[model samples]
Target: MPTTSPFALLLDVDGPIASPVTRDVAPEIIGLLLDLAVSGIPVVFNTGRSDDFIKQQVMAPMIAAGMPSTLKIHAICEKGATWFTFDSTGAGEVQVDHDLAVPGHYSDEIRELVASSFASHMFFDETKRAMVSVEQNIDADNTEYRRVQADFDAAALEAMIRLGLGVERLEVSLPDANSGIEYRVDPTIISTDIESVALGKDLGARRALNLLSADGIVPGAWFTVGDSRTDYAMADWLAAHGHEVSHVDVRPGDGIPAGKPYPVLTAGDLGLGDEVIHDHAGLAFLRHWRAQLDPGMVINSTELSEASV
Candidate 1:
């Protein structure tokens, strides 16, 4: 294996960091994150959650749960539409870099098309940069969620086709059929300005990664963990840039993209698959990677105690 030390961990909040809805992070997984922090690995939270939402919902809970205070942690939020850095000097201060958030120069026609076709379902939110959040009426209990998703998917597919934005991508996903479903359109489609809205999200993630690299963060040495189609672009970007990508899902096969050659760590069908982070097989892999950082650091023996079971 290629040896690299002090690897940066890019974690996806919903899948690897915390469970959905209940907002509970497993004890063992917390231990693992704590261990990584204690061992001096830099971990960055990369997610679709907004900056304010991540701090309040994810980071705050982790810190309260005895996570290491000295760890060098960073965050890329809003589906890579924003980047924030937390350092020893700043302490609780979060510095935002907006250049990464702006969807590179896009044509006006794409915006008009999105506005006309999905007027009721889509609207622009002015958080970091103007991003269009497409709301889909989905029924989680009934079969309507899937139907709604298909409609949204068809709209995005058709938009992309009409605009001819290759290289620029749009990501359509079922956020949480239980709570609600939302998708994002990109800002820059090649052929038609109308398709740019579908490409906004895909463009944002790519821009964020580019910004990270431009700021001296190497992609090949970085690791990203996530779940869902919105995260697929980031995964694909990392893998293409020679970075290691891991997908963490509560259920092994649930919602994960098919035919991606990356490794996936599952917490089982429900949340029972926590062993993927707590057990020997999982810990061993983490330790092996951490070992490249500091040879003296050791994997906790207790982690693998249940291996025979």
Candidate 2:
């Protein structure tokens, strides 16, 4: 069945598109994606990767592997914390719309908590809002992940109470067992002052989406893809808002649900999973969904791009 709405193909990087280090992208899958592009289907890659990293590592190689130069491919990087558009006119340069920089005007108490806790573990990186994260190696088998996690949790709560800041949202994430902890802080409850440090690491992706939506990029026409639990905010937001397509879980055990609130596609294993997405089963699934939607639905990719500009 032919797709009607010119669907947005949201791809996750590590699982569905490319492998790490080798940076090998599947040729047949690229061909299929390019075919989708030629048919005017916009393919936007959404992942936890940063903007500079995606261009140097993922997009460049993909274009080298036959993806079109003018392929209207957009990227939501940093787990959807930042948004970028590849300028086909400028040697494929990526333009950033949102960044994970901490907002200015953070309460002094929040800063003190971060400074006090920063030395206990090498795991802490930066503080945003009431949350602080570090880069300590976590033993998935040690049962101590919870203990260390509790420490962070306690710190977050104390910081909020001491500073008279209210919690909006908080999360402690382990992006990699070897990479350390990733934390998020949402302090809209404290004030709309928008402190630079209040944005936190994990909130980047969700913040980017909110920024895009505010610019009139309706959720129904948008799609998001990611490899890990860190990407959950963007995925959850899109699903709750009824996005047209939200392809997630491009990595093995990315912890994506088997049946999602939205249509889900899993790549099975990293890099090699691209082959599965291009197979007959994958195509059939897309086709079946496409046949049900109305044609000529206007999607506002420019809204996201314009906001970034």
Candidate 3:
């Protein structure tokens, strides 16, 4: 009923929307997302999460909340190796690039590695159709997950090398003298996703744009929200391709990247405290955007002018 929102959202799932600890989205967050969608904003989820996870944790709850069929939402999952769209009826077709998948043996090896060595802290995600992911158990402590994460990664890396596969770990500072690394063992706050070097958030952003175009919708601008450093690729791609965009780092405690061309802001900019990170910050961002879209809304004290970087 309201005019279509001027901005579209490209979002990552794990930290920004879903709680990394519980691996579930809060009802308030879901309500806000439904409001955003009902107002006709294009809400596209781009993440390393599998389509199945998105379907269960995101789409199922949304559908149960009575999402309108008119709202077409797209999800780019497995870091762009797979994707799907859904509306009120249910999920639609899923598209996966088999060529982009890591060798099946790698997933098998990694599964055994997790089960054998890191079962307490992590579990191999079987729902992933393309990339191999080992997620932190919902009950596992974050500190414990981080403690065993590197050992699992190293074991997986050694397996890849044993199989004569060229591989690297994501976010590693150094690349070897040999320049033929093909895949990366990427570790995040609550998971380790081993995927092709080619698969990234940038690819997901491009896919989201194409999906929106296919639906005959063009947003005036875009907002990308994520909790990790890798999530910057979405905003990076949009900015490089000449789109008006801003990026929000829901969790900036790790460190924010320097010298980004587009603006990068956080809930902290909007008067939230440092302790409110991850999904809480994400919820604040959604509220901020929602307030901006509907001028009738009012903030008690904080100035929106101060928040815009």
Give the per-residue lDDT of model 2 (tens digit) for 22-89.
Answer: 33555544555555656655556664445665676656656676665555456665444456665343
Assess each prediction's global lDDT (C-alpha) against the native.
0.47, 0.44, 0.86
| Residues forming the 10-long window of minimal summed lDDT in candidate 3 | 300-309
For model 1, give the RMSD to the true fold.
9.8
| Shift in Å, residue 48, candidate 1 | 1.1
Runs with alpha carbons beyond 4 Å of true place in candidate 3: 1-5, 171-179, 301-309
Candidate 3 overall lDDT versus native? 0.86
Error of 3 at 271 (Å): 1.3
Q: Lowest summed-lDDT stretch of 10 residues in model 1?
A: 188-197
How many clashes (backbone N, Cα, C below 3 Å) per candidate?
A: 15, 20, 0
Q: In angstroms, give how far residue 267 of model 2 lies from its true place.
A: 6.5
* Residue-by-residue lDDT tens digits, candidate 3, 150-213: 8888887888778777788865522334657888889898888888899999999999999888
Which structure is stronger by TM-score: 1 or 3? 3
- The true-versus-predicted C-alpha distance at residue 115 of model 2, in Å, is 20
lDDT of 1 by residue, 212-233 (tens): 5555555445555554455556
TM-score per candidate, chains pooled: 0.52, 0.48, 0.93
Best by TM-score: 3
